[model samples]
Target chain A: MQASLFVSCIVDQFFPEVGESTVRVLRRLGVDVDFPPGQTCCGQPAFNSGFWNEAKPLARRLLRQLEGKEHVVVPSGSCASMLRVFYAELLRDEPAALHAAKELAPRVYELSEFIVDVLKVTDASEIGGRPRREPEKVTYHEGCHLRRELGAVTQARALIGSAPGAELVEMEQPDVCCGFGGLFSVKYPDISGAMLADKIDDIRRTGAGAVAACDSSCLMQIGGGLRAQGLPIRTVHLAQLLDEAATPG
Target chain B: MEATTKQFTQSAAKTLSDARIQDSLRGLYGGFSKARERAAEATPGWEEMRTRAQAVKSHTIANLDYYLEQVEARVTESGGNVFFAQDGEAASRYILDLAERESVKRVIKGKSMLSEEMDLNRLLAGAGVEVTETDLGEYLIQLAGDTPYHIIAPAIHMSKNRAAELLHRGVGAEGREWDTAELTAEARRQLRDKFIEADMGITGANFVVAETGTLVLVTNEGNGRMCTSMPRIHVAVMGMEKVAPTLEDMSMFLRLLTRSATGQRLSAYVTTVDGPRGPGDEDGPEQFHLVVVDNGRSRILADPHMREALNCIRCGACLNACPVYRKVGGHAYGWVYSGPIGAIVTPMLTNLPDSRDLPYASSLCGACREACPVRIDIPRMLLHLRRELAEGRNKNAPVAEAALMKVWRLSVSNSGTLAAANLIGRALRWPLLLLGRLLPPFSRWARYRELPRPVSPFRSRWKDIFRT
Candidate 1:
């Protein structure tokens, strides 16, 4: 099965390794991954900033890029949700673009959702490589759109749960937003920081060696906090986790 | 009640800096939010109930004129006067006029956000009526001369010690380290006499059942019962959108609202007040008046994108679930409502220009939507309001932000411009943060957390990675 990778702009610029990891994981799962290098963004920032009109041109552009793809896998849940939910809302008045959005939305899937649900990779051992001497204890952060928008809570957990090389531990209120609400981080840093502190508290209490998440936007916020506070815990994309497990290191 | 929504950020900073308010606000998540989660989890068909409630609200709001007319006719038929106030001022004026005409000496009240919207207590007290809030939380805040920090728990920001102090200073309580029980008892003692001596009892409606013009109130303290019964005159001030078509519709709402608000299978009191005391009635007011306030609801209803916000049942679930609300608490929103619902309603019901920051306060996390019993898409409405503000509906819309968005539109509208921007972004070590940290708003981003380290654009390396 072939799937086109909609490498989100965040992953494209700030974290290229996550894009590589996503590609590695997808290829290992026997899904032929293709990239449309022309892809720029899902227009979430402008869309989320309430500049729907400004978001429209980019959204229209992205729609044309993703046209005719069988399954479009995005590395970020917020971006995926932007394409699936906000795109339609933004482009509602434009008949052709809105029609394109409607067609593309059903095919759009977040990485983990595409992996477990679409690719049918139920157990992680199938892709997990060498068993670790010490199982990597990892906690997961549920991105708002990943869980709430896509409702794919179990897919990522299922993969991590069944992995032979990793142990999946739960954190309190993992589904709560990490406060990287696009421009919100910039506009109201104090409230966002306060929320991030709470989230970090939960992650710390879990005593996990690493935090895993499907969306890089969440990782940017989570990982940023973890680093600023000089915490030892590492942050990884689920694709990286899956790819590392599948690699015989 | 004035729109200090512009001060949301400053007020949020105040809440953040205060250790006590922070501690008090934490209960929203662990206490009320957890309880609501458990109740919904335990109840079968909870989702179905929410969907049904949304459907009911949608139909009711779409035909609000019809239902409201039915309410007026039925209320009149049952010997209750129905007055539709165009806004809070109109509502307050009508209510004050009635209080004046009746020569009301003392007035008792149940908890009502609508009353806060009307600024009723202050207005009535200014008119020389001794207005007393009967709900424990409302009474505490009333005594403290404080605005409500929450929708259901009006005095949620206050601690037991604060309550103790308020009771001592305001009502001559003799104790200091009073616990919740003692504080509640003290509140009851203070309000009990006012209930009987009051010439009028004014309350807010949870649902105004249009079929019979019945006002259903759900409360834990039974204050609703007293406020609707003992006084010679009973007056209910409600937002016009609070109407339900029938008792059955009200029942569905009751099932979801109490659970969503306080995690109760049922509130301690589910008081439904019809017009007034019948000839054979053992208890109830002799005269009843229903004051339906528009208060910019018609304006919100006028927008198709925003009308869903009218579905809110005032359960406060959205507040409990909102991460932003949990941090800033209610006072930050600077209005009767706070949290997610407050963010939307305050801007719409009041001035969007002054409350511009209110809509943008959230991270657009969608938690409020999940927590809503009627399933109000708060984030959606917030986005619409944001769009309205961004489109310069609000006079305070920043030209700089508008210009930046325009620049952003030019950049990402195509792959070519995007690549060029990414090239600059990549070479500049440019996560935008490195440059943004030099700026004001973006400066806040780096204060609490480090921005991501720079990396090469994925597009530049994708071809090389793909060949492998």
Candidate 2:
């Protein structure tokens, strides 16, 4: 099977390791991974910020980039949702972009979803992850768009739960947002910070070695908070957590 | 009563600093939210029920004028007065004029958010009528001189000791230590008298069944019934959109309402008042006046995008489900309604330009949409309000923001512009980290999280990185 990577603008620019892990995991599963060059952002930040007009062009660009790919894997849930769910809404006025988005949506997948649903890799070890030197604790933070928009609630957890190298601590309200809501984190910093504090507290209570999630934006938020709190916990993407770089054994 | 929604950020900041309120707010998830989840899970075909209810509400709202006229005819036939109040002032005028004519000196209330919307208590007191809030939560908050911290749990932000202190001070009780039970008992005792002595009772309508001309109030406390049955004159005010087409439709609404509001199969009292005392009625109010309030609802109903907001049952399931509401609590919303619903309702009902910050208060996490029984897409409404703000359809359209978003639009209009922008971003990344802390909006983000340094744009390294 072939999967064209849509390295969402965040994974593309700020978190290349996440993109690398995603590619490696797909490759290890005997699925050919291809990076479509013209791919840029799925235009979520603007789309979410109510600048749908600003977002529509980017959505058009992406739909053009992956019009006929067999599978388009996005590392970020928010970006994937933009392609899979919101692109149609953003491009409804333009008949051509709208049609292309509708055609391309079923092909688009968040990484964990592609692995579990499309690739049918139920266990982490099947995709290059081996038992670690010691068991590491990892809790999954369900990204809102990933869990709610894509409705892939248990795929990430199932993969993590089945990882022999790691123990899933299952933090309280794992589905709660980490409050890195694009411009929201900046717009309402106090409320965002308070929510982030609660999320950090939940992660701390689990005593997890790392917090795993599909989207880099959430990982960035959690990772930054952990670093700020002077905690040693790692924030691993679902792809990174399943990759050999994070696999100890 | 006055719209202070403009102070949302400052109020939210204040709420965040207060540890006590924060601790209290945290309980909403476990107490109300989880219970709602359990109730929905336990119910058979909860999703289908929500869908069916949404369809009924949508139909009822679309043909609201027809149902409303049906209601007016039936109500008038039953010898009850029906007043179409254009706004809060009109509602107040009708009620106050009725109060003067009836020589009403005491007024008792059921838990009515519309009462808050109308500023009824202050206006009545100013008219020299003794107005007492009959709902325990409403009474305590009124006594403490605080607005509702929540729709259902009016005093949720107030600690037990604080509630006791305020109640003792306001109720003119002897200063002493009090627990929840004793304080509740005292409030009951005080309000019990007001219910009996009151000449007029004012309540909010939960749902008005048009087929039967029935006005309903769903309350956990029995005060709603007391207010309805005990007074000589009973007045119910409601937003014009809350009409259920039939008693069967109302039953479906009842099923959705209690479960959504407090996770109960049924509240303690479901008081359905059809009209004033009938010819042979044993015990009920002598006179009934149904004041149907518009208060900007017509404007909302005309707008296709925002009309869904009127479908809100005021169940407050959205408030419990909101992360932003959980953090900031109700007062920060700066209006009668709060949380995700308030964010849209306040701006539209009051004035968008006045309550501009309310729309921007959320992270658009969408928990509210999931929790809404009628499925009001709150995030979509917020986004619409944001777009309106961005467009500056109203006078105060933050023009500065338009310039920045335009630049952002230009930068990411295509792959090449974005890549070029990325180059510029890389050069300025470090400077952003430093200057970001000093700036207004960037500082909001950088103050909390350590900004990641920009790496080489992925396209720049794609060929080398992808080669095996």
In terms of docking quality, model 2 is medium
RMSD of each: 1.8, 2.0
Per-residue lDDT, model 2, residue B320, is 94
Supply the TM-score for candidate 2: 0.96
lDDT of each: 0.87, 0.86
Would you list the clashing residue pairs of candidate 1? A129-A245
Cα lDDT of model 2 overall?
0.86
Worst 10 residues of 2 chain B by lDDT: B391-400
Tell me the tens digit of each residue's lDDT in model 1 across A24-132: 8887788888998678888888888778777887888888888999999998888999898888889989999999999999999999888788878889878756754
TM-score of chain A of each: 0.97, 0.96
lDDT of 1 by residue, B1-468 (tens): 666887888899999999988888887888999999999999999999899889999999999999999999999999899999998999999988988898889999988999888888888878888888888888889878899998898888887888888876745544545779887787788777888799999999999999998899999989888989999999999999999999999999999998999899999999988799989989889999999999999988998998998988999999999999999999999998999999988878888888889989999889999999988888888888888887645545588887887887777766788777766765676646667777777677887788765566777788776855
Q: Per-residue lDDT for B403 in model 1?
A: 83
Error of 1 at A113 (Å): 0.8
**Top model number, DockQ:** 1
DockQ of 1: 0.78
